[model samples]
Target chain A: MLPEENVREYYMIRDIRDTPKALDAVVKSLDGISEVAASARKFRKIFFIGCGSSYYAVLFGSWPLMKNGSVLAFALPSSELILHFSDAVNSDSLVVGVSRSGRTAETLKALEICRGKGAYTVGFTIEGGSEITGIVDEPVVLDIGEEKSIIMTKSFTAFSLSTAMFSSILSERISGEKQTLIDECKAIPSLARSLLSYEDKIAATSKRLLSENIERFIFLGSGPSYPIALEGALKVKETSYVATEGLHLLEFRHGPMATIGERLTLVISCFLGENTVHLKNFVSEFAGKGADIILISNSIDLGESTLKLPPEYSGECKALLSIIPMQILAYYYAVGKGRDPDKPRNLSRYIQRF
Target chain B: MLPEENVREYYMIRDIRDTPKALDAVVKSLDGISEVAASARKFRKIFFIGCGSSYYAVLFGSWPLMKNGSVLAFALPSSELILHFSDAVNSDSLVVGVSRSGRTAETLKALEICRGKGAYTVGFTIEGGSEITGIVDEPVVLDIGEEKSIIMTKSFTAFSLSTAMFSSILSERISGEKQTLIDECKAIPSLARSLLSYEDKIAATSKRLLSENIERFIFLGSGPSYPIALEGALKVKETSYVATEGLHLLEFRHGPMATIGERLTLVISCFLGENTVHLKNFVSEFAGKGADIILISNSIDLGESTLKLPPEYSGECKALLSIIPMQILAYYYAVGKGRDPDKPRNLSRYIQRF
Candidate 1:
């Protein structure tokens, strides 16, 4: 490998390690969350919009509002919002656009269109004075510092946590009830810090899997973990240049399970809720079909392959933590295959062109 | 091949050919659609719930209600609704459950939960007096005859047309304006019939592509065509047992574009609207990467590989028509690969368990 490749890989690993610090910074900077939540309560419909990894984060963030069945929250790709669903944004709607660079062209255009429609717009980004800050009615800028790697690792977790914090506060304000999830969100930084200690183990696991010559990867998650699965798949695809897919846990069984074979690897995030038993059964079924299974969970233990997370975190908190190991796996897999994780082929930091 | 496999393949082809007939029956049986639409006007939010192909169908069906920006319409997998988002269903919500068998376990359970929460329930099914019909308050049972094949081809199109019809009626009722799409929908059966004349051409194209030994397939669509892209991917995955993925048109550029290379084939649904130029540019970029491109469009043509649809149809109408070629492609691809499209591995007609 070239000396420059080594330097770029170091940047990716450093970004992965800096996740907890980034989350801590974002958590400490939540002064305007309640006011944003208050304004969100007035809107009948709320849209969380972003592109790529940011889209997955906003999808995770929109979960709190969706779980109560009262607020109608939709998380969409910014391009979809601008081209197709722009008619859905009206005066009674709230739009939240999340981008690490805060200058994703589709997101900026989406925010501008929503603003023109008289919808309340909020921007979430690590950059304080980027284009999105000026386009949105409210800006929740995180002072999490810059990420050197082209792939989003620290900002993904930070943005998801920030959006979840806002959604949880909004849910509480709407229901006139106190929420404990916000407190759990506060504890996520330390949890993420503790997870950083498992980097060596994750790297070893990824190297072992890479040695297997797996041709395809499938990630599955239920509920809030669904978007995490998507982010995991994207991480592997962009960094390692492998064909990977993320789907809702049961949605996999519907048709996608047919792809299970000797050269396939499955990474599943099994939540400790209603679908736990089913998730286990499905994992065993995939394993029986000769596919390798790497199960990530907070509670369920399925022998040696399960990457057990720190228990007692809520679904949202677990969602935030689950992507860390996946990000590490993507990093190591890229390095194992002699690819640079900092600069994946055919991708830029953010899409600025139409 | 076994004689039984041949018989099953025959059934699948017959079902594909019978699509127009089934769609004609569904379009003719819209007697009580206005009543359902009028009732939907009272609800603040609407959820379209289904499993597998039904899920994608309802997603296409939900586009009309989603487009006006007045009503909040969401299409979710039944398992997601029952396990994750049940709390979002309430008295002010209207839930529409769709199943070809009318006995999908998750769909039935979701309907029951929503009904218990006082949400108005509607069920779209080909099977009358099935479990879903008993569970939902309103049953829009199409008297289209049974599908002999395990894969849902005719029923998929029929259910999507029915849902789109209902959604179009609801949008009109809510906005107090006439929808030309509904009139365009009424003309779909004839269009589908006319398109079937090109089956031999579609089969030749599929066989030619299969001969290249493509390793992966990606389908991309925008607006109303997005769910069609997903359904196309599902059809290829379930029928051919190949690794296939479907995503929004621009979402492909985000990160998944890394997978574009020599053994990759892409099927894109390009509407002749705002994103046409961007879609063309992306297609050429992928083509430059040594991937085969199949452009399915109503207006735009990109040389020999473009599968042009009959012009003058609305986006919704074009979405309904685009999948026919994909269905035919999946059929021939399976047959050419010595696999039976009638019964794909690891899948049942309806998921009754969990």
Candidate 2:
């Protein structure tokens, strides 16, 4: 076990440890989320906007809205929302901004622009009375999801879980579907807590596997896990200063698989889904090519390197919990590389520049 | 100039050389594209689907539908369409599949799934009577855009142009927007022909820049050129076996800029857009960090490294023509690394597997 000083030095680990509590708090605020989802139904289009890890949070958050809700929904980076998609936002549109501090300049500017176009705006942040709340019409704050570290950990998972719950509620209301989302969300905190119990195992495995001349990492996932993969890759890239790329599971085989070799390690998020067969096939193909693979999946064993979670979890819960082991891996890999996980090179906690 | 045998050895160059003619043929098929656009109006949603270079083509193609045409549009890989977006497809959707070869199994499967959901399906390929045409309800073939090389070149540009024209025509019908798209498209073949004149220069520049231990590339763009950036990165990754990542212009500064160093070269696609100022600021920031930057834009000279295109070109024409120099760069970069451009390592002409 690591010393208390060393563990405290890795402040992101503390935030990671808080994820289960964050999930529980978010689940408790389901009524508030449902209120936001009710207003979301009035909009013709829904746009999710944020920056960096928060942008990926939007990618994970927008899925349920697009798949189950009636409105056409999209997730774009805050800068992209302002620059490339201005025409798509109109009076009938809804812009949802996701940021931990609620002070990302681009996200604030994007909300301002959307509101200027007469679009209803919503803000999701950990701060109750932040800058975003003043600019947007509605604000849903998850105070327990707040982070003490520069790198996002609990907030990303918590905000994404909240948005997933929001979209699922909207789905139930719009389509009269069974309210399966609420029951599943009720189980997520415990599931996430159970997942955190594997932290030491993940850290040990990461050190054992990555100690041998690994230079690049490829993180792959499909469906909701796709954005989780992107976030995982970014966490590694930001923390350890390693070259990492995240892609859709099947999209990797199309072209990026060419770069797979001995120096590469594949981190796959193979949640329980219809595409599990294809993911296994891809893993076997990569394994034949002498690449090391670390699979984070539910119950299904893809060999000895897999970190299996509890089986039969709902889709929403699986999406939120799949990134836990990856976050642990990134943390340990940073320590292995002898870098400060608190301050990633050449990055700021908030992008203030216009 | 290269020797005859060497030139003949590069089959991809032959395809690149045929781009102008391909553009002309696609321009001639504008009536067919208009017909497809007419049918597209019946759908509430338009989804563009493909894989790899063809998937980038879909990203390029979907822009016009989302921005100019009066419908909700999205571009996704064919695999994503089949796997994650099943709920988004219904009787009120139109799925457009783009493939250079009509034999790509995923595209056909995506169309099959879309049709199974009662969505109208349209196919675009170089093969007139191929499997995609049989699978989809409507098929439009640009026969002249067919390629003999493993990598796609002309077809990507041609199909994107046809789709841009398709969306423009749809916009014209729905909103009575002026027919500037038609006049702009008429200039594309000539512009593409003129772009080929810079092939030798691009090769020379690529060789010089890459000669000094460059291993990774970052391609950045905004608006229509964003997909161009992705396609450019894929081309280099596929052909030269070099590590390349493409990202939106503003999105890069958010985090990935932390990865910038001496070994990384920034390939920027800057067309005439409102975000020009912000892009220039980003370039300045990267330049101050001592990283190499190569800019591809229309008559906008940020520095000596900038490759200038013909001035006063419309957005659609600029988007189609911007990838010319990048394609040439990838081709010669492959040749410089002594890899066969036609037979890139760990890749195939089509992805037939699930």
Q: List, residue by residue over B118-227, the lDDT tens digit for candidate 1.
A: 99999999898899889888888888899998888989999899899998888887888898778888888988898788777777778678888875788998888889
- Model 1 segments beyond 4 Å from truth? A1-8, A38-41, A274-279, A288-290, B1-9, B38-41, B272-279, B288-290
Off-target runs (Cα >4 Å) in candidate 2 are A2-8, A39-41, A314-317, B2-8, B39-41, B68-70, B314-317
Which stretch of 10 consecutive residues in model 2 chain B shows the poorest summed lDDT?
B1-10
lDDT (0-100) at residue A335 of candidate 2? Answer: 80
Q: Model 2, range A1-354, lDDT digits (tens) per residue?
A: 356436545788889999998888998998888888786547677788999888988888777776662567788889877877887789988888998888899999999999999999999999878899899998999968458778888998988888778767766766677756668778888888888888878877777756786757888887788899999988887887667777778887777767765267889888746566565776788777776889887745767788876666546447767888888888888887777888877778888877
- How many angstroms is residue B299 displaced in model 2 relative to the true structure, after the best TM-score fit? 5.5
lDDT of 1 by residue, A40-104 (tens): 54778889999999999999998888786576688999999988778778898999999889999
| TM-score (C-alpha, index-matched) for candidate 2 | 0.95
Question: Which one wins on DockQ?
Answer: 1
